[model samples]
Target chain A: MLLDDAVLRAIMRGLHITGSFVLFGNCVLQGWLLPAPVKPWVQARLRVISQGSFAVLFIAGICWFVLQTVDMSGAQDAGDIWQALPVVAGSTRFGGLLIGRLVGFTLAALALWLGWRRGAAVLAGAALAAEGWLGHGGAMPGPVGTLLLGSAVLHLLSGGVWLGSLPGLWVGLRGLDMAQAAVLARRFSPLGVVCVIGLLLSASVQYLILIGSPAALLNSGYGQLALLKMSLLLGLLALAAVNRYHLAPRLPMGDELARRLLLRSVVAEMALGLLAVLAAGQLLQLAPPAMAAMLGQSGG
Target chain B: MKLVNLIALALLLGISPAFAHAFLAKSDPPVGSVVHGAPKMLVLSFTEDLEVPFCRVAVSDSMGMNDAAGKPQAVPGHPNELMVPLNIQMPGKVSVIWHALSVDTHKTQGNFSFTVTP
Candidate 1:
């Protein structure tokens, strides 16, 4: 069954990652692109992506929480809720991450509420940044976690702007005036550059977290999947480069071929993003590189 | 929406107490039961499936004596229940304690006492 218990867990992980990507992507678009002229259309699209993903993420998150609680070991039952609360609050790094994630989620929800007002997009972006921080970034400890958290915030903000522009590009290609499309392209390109930089930075931090030693890249499944994700991201970057350097500048010519090329490249990038999301889901189940080594040490 | 949020908050608060893993529900010898003759075996029942490898059941006499037949062995096909055979029939109060590290990494312990009379 596609929805079997194990599959459900995987699916929950996938939904969480995908939702974060979409939310972050949209926030980037709203914050970076969406020049005054195209703000309305961009805002509408952002609303759809953000709210829709949030609903799915909320439901999947609830399901995951239920499963975890129900399957907790009997030892957890010894304490009352008041007692358990402190234990859960104090137990593992995972617990702290979970609490942080909840706080981030609440912030995101508040940002969504504020989006109907002026300058609310910035607030929404901040909330999305926080979301990324708490989700996987907070899974580490001390300085490493803080670095991950900051990089993730920047990564999410930039990703939001970059990925959020896809639909806009699609719409622009369909029937929008050439001059207006060119204008939007000009506004988006620089932001896309900045977002790419942030993505690369956060991605490097995540890789460091996952691949402790160069040897682990070959030794562990987590490292292998991480390598695969890195390859896909590189491919995406190459496509973005083509779009930025080759295709974007030719928009004034109203060339259908260039538009199609951009569209195809964006589609490919989106596919690669999906693969990255799946890899992330798999990675969640695997121990971090340092932890894996520690386990090996204990066993040996 | 406000009401829905309130309901959700209530549910979250209410359900926090319900999180529990499989626990020892009952024991065959029964806690503090006094009986004549040594028990043949000790059987433990739990609330959910257990990873059997980590489970152990022990029988100890009044002087802190271990009366294990050999070693704790799995009751084939019943992962949740662990059994250990008794070697000697003694007429004394005995304590049975179960210890296990569950699959979820939670450590579990449950104990009961019974007495053998002459």
Candidate 2:
């Protein structure tokens, strides 16, 4: 069967998303850190992580997407999948996006390896952005599908900028002075708020279409996982609030302790972000709430 | 960010594939074909796997008499293949109606007729 072992599929999927998010977050962090008055060594380390991930994640993403082709065609086994791959990828919308993502990720990875950061950044960003073209939105039909795809894309990119950037933000804080740390915090707070707004707006609309009913969240596996992702998002927001109101102001006054505290919080948020990404990977494997109900009622 | 957004939009415009329906891909007694004689089974193949409980196939004679066939079941290890046993004591133009629900929960249905020559 295409995904005979559910656990194996989830693990592969989780690793794929986490890998992509790592690259995305690191790239955004690199942007944030470079403008900071951090030590050369610290900046160099972040650059190394970002560049290396761009390369690693590109290959990983392609393999994962290839394996993921089972989602489009109802291929029951590996042999069936292998036979279906060329035709399915050639014909389907999902295949088209996967191919695009593969090409974009490859070029981005190569550019980064060749020390072309700017080009890599653009290409890598595009690669991640195309994910909306697949997943739940891809399954949906009509103009509603287009709308959902747009929302999902915005949601993912905003997340890439926000949650994906957290690790770098945590690491970048280590090398900054109290004032620079405060300035960095100040710079990120507004951006975080804006991104959060985007996340909330998109999420609410997505919930309406994808979830259909709140009761499904409790009854269905897909719903339960979505709840977990939302919980993690809430935790991240709490940390952001803590940083914005409490730690950020403290940093401008040279509070070394507050800088340390803020770094810890960012790390905590980053951990949560990864968890959310993990859940998201598994979520995509599931049928949406209303659909899951139908599957249960109908599948013999 | 705007460029990224623009690229996604440009790439996705008008590219949505109209799939998700479990349309009939083939059949045992192919649609509208003239069979040599009465068939013992009615088998339908779909574009995707069928939810066995929700998918069913009904065979009937030209006089609209229903076949007391075996309950529809997906051919084991073959998700897209559904087969129904037939009690074809007599046949003229055998009509087959099928309704299939894919695992993803998309529903589709259709019917076709094939002549069973004397």
Q: State how far residue A47 of model 2 sits from its true place (Å).
A: 2.6
TM-score for the A chain of candidate 1:
0.75
DockQ of each: 0.02, 0.07
Shift of residue A254 alpha carbon in model 2, Å? 1.7
Q: Given candidate 1, what's the lDDT at residue B74?
A: 63
B30-117: candidate 1 lDDT, tens digit per residue: 6667767777887776533444544667778888878878666667776556677885456888877777533333345666777788
- Give the per-residue lDDT of model 1 (tens digit) for A169-282: 555544356666666677777877877777776676555544545787777776788788778878878988898899878888887687778778777877777777667566
- How far in Å is the alpha carbon of A225 misplaced in model 2? 1.4
Once model 2 is optimally superposed onto the true structure by TM-score, how far is the C-alpha of residue A260 displaced, in angstroms? 1.2
TM-score of 2: 0.69
In model 2 chain B, the worst 10-residue window by lDDT is: B14-23
For model 2, residues A260-290, the per-residue Cα lDDT tens digits are 8988898898789878877887786666665
Q: What is the TM-score of chain B alone in each candidate?
A: 0.72, 0.81
Where does model 2 sit among the CAPRI classes? incorrect
- Ten residues in a row with the worst lDDT in model 2 chain A? A291-300
